[model samples]
Target: MINKKLIAPFYERLSLVLIGILALGFIIVQGKEILDPLMFGFLFAILLLPVSGFFEQKLRMPRSASSFLAIILLVAFVGGVLYR
Candidate 1:
């Protein structure tokens, strides 16, 4: 036979998880436009992190200068590819 106490907690936790998922889905749907560029910017920053670190550590450039140089390098790379 199944234990009733064990079943109740399981259902309760499942319901809470389902509700949380629904809430997150609703928020994402509502914020699609606002979230889109922010997410891209976040991803772009992550991609640039390594290049920036290289300039900062190996070349000993300042943080701001390294970040700007990394951005320019990436833009030039992308532009070259698209222009070809």
Candidate 2:
């Protein structure tokens, strides 16, 4: 007998485990295709680190201000890339 009260939590946990396994399977299947974008994002983040440091340390700006300016610059650069 599947008791609703007792089995509900068990089913929920099983569902979550299944979902995690499926996600892992998908990643394994598509793993090779994922590295390029991951590396690109990593390098881009490394490049941004200096600009953030410049704003925060050299310019004595707040983190929020630095972040906003960085985002704006990134958007502009992306727009330029797309336009060209």
- The top-ranked prediction according to TM-score is 1
Name model 2 segments beyond 4 Å from true.
1-29
Error of 1 at 67 (Å): 0.3
How big is the RMSD of model 2?
9.0
Tens digits of per-residue lDDT for model 1, 15-65: 999999999999999999999999999999999999999999999999999
Q: Write the per-residue lDDT of candidate 2 for residues 1-84, one digit (tens) a residue.
A: 875654568789999999999999888778958877888878877878788889999999999898778778988999999995
Whole-model alpha-carbon lDDT for candidate 1: 0.96
User: What is the C-alpha local distance difference test score of candidate 2?
Assistant: 0.85
What lDDT does candidate 1 reach at residue 84? Answer: 50
- Candidate 2 clashes between residue pairs 3 or more apart in a chain or in different chains: none
- In order, candidate lDDTs are 0.96, 0.85
Residue 50 error, candidate 2, Å: 1.2
lDDT score, candidate 2, position 8: 62
Best of the candidates, lDDT: 1
